[model samples]
Target: DLQQQALDSLVQHLADHHNAEALGVLCDVADAAAVERAMALTVERFGGIDVLVNNAGITHRSSFADTELAVFQRIMAVNYFGALHCTKAALPSLIARSGQIIVLSSLSGFAPLLYRSAYNSSKHALHGLFETLRYELKGSGVNVMLVCPGFTATDLRKNALVGDGSVAAQPPLAMGKVASPQDVAEAIYHGALKRRRLLVLSNVDWRARVLARFFPRLFERVLLPRLSGLKPQRAGRF
Candidate 1:
């Protein structure tokens, strides 16, 4: 749980819905010590961590020039360093068990979007770090999966930061199908079970990945106007 209320909500949700025992621990993944404590609690509750899911993330939705430096820093702290700290804390158990590591990346991990410089950067960092880790753990039996979900219907949208670091009051422009959070979760679950290296959910996400890979210049030209909620200027007759 990243926040106190998040822990309470998880506990209550588990109590109300699931019969299996669930453990909750408060952690600020940005803090190495906090992650250690949370992982320790997890180990104390269970025998060992078989799977490490680095899913906690935050987003900033302001243009690079307008967005505050602090906003970018905060996003990196939660989205990149957060996962780094958690993975570091859980590595020993994961190595011993040949456990799986599931990283919650985004379509932006490969596809760039305007007004999301910080968000995209964090995810790109995850890909670089985990892809290297995957090679290192190839024969060690620990499989890594990076799940890239397209725009999902979730609270992260409500928490997106604007230029001044304030939450954006309006909802984001709909550039693609907004997948249900449940759908994304189920896809991630199955992908982890199958030991997939990179799972891009939804057709929209796949298109984004493909465009970025094979038609990057075209993708960038189209994405800028779309994300900015504007139409690109047409070439005027000279």
Candidate 2:
């Protein structure tokens, strides 16, 4: 988490409710050095790493024309580079233990979404990077799982960045049934246990993935209407 207080709260909750031993290390995933330090501390505390979950992410809600270049950079820093940093720092420990790397990508990773160019591109990059890494680590026993979850009920939407980097005034419209974080977590846990390569949570996201891959034209026609309400008022420069 970005906030130490929230991290502490979560740690306490896990300890109290789940009787789980969890160390809350406050480190921003975008910062490579911080990630390294956090990973080192975890390895030191736990003796070795068994699983590394790259779930850090952020989103932006702005048309490409309205969005400043810095906004794209910021979003990429948190969503893409953040995962890259954690993966790099934890790779050696993961490899040593023949561990698993679970990446939390989104349906937008493959399918496009309106006014979310930065977010979509970052998730797409994760697929390209991690999927390739999976093949490279085939004999290493380090499983790489990519999780694509559809619209989940989270504060991510409320905290979405706008064109100028401010929080988005309005969250994007929900196209299908929104999933709960708990349901997504359960799916991820099962996927990891089975060492599944790709886990697309939710029926809606699964349909989107199929449509986007097999019928691009039809996907555009179907998805465009659901996302049309999200189009920015300002005319796109392109």
Report the C-alpha lDDT of model 2 over 1-238, residue by residue, as the tens digit. Answer: 7799998999999999999999999999889999999999999999989999998888888899999999899889988999999999999999999999999998888888878999999999999999899999999989999998777899888788999999878876677788999999998999999999999876767877887898766667665446545332332322
- Compared with the true structure, the alpha-carbon lDDT of candidate 2 equals 0.87
Clashing pairs in 2: none
Judge candidate 1 at residue 157 and give its lDDT.
78
Q: How far off is residue 40 in model 1, in Å?
A: 0.7
TM-score for each candidate, following the candidate numbering: 0.92, 0.93
lDDT of 1 by residue, 1-238 (tens): 6577877888889888986577878778889998999899888899899999998998867779999889989899999999999999999999989999999998878878788999999999999999999999888889999998877888887788898888889867666678898898898889988999999886767866876798766556665466556785443332
Give the alpha-carbon lDDT of every model: 0.85, 0.87
RMSD of each: 2.7, 4.1
Best candidate, TM-score: 2
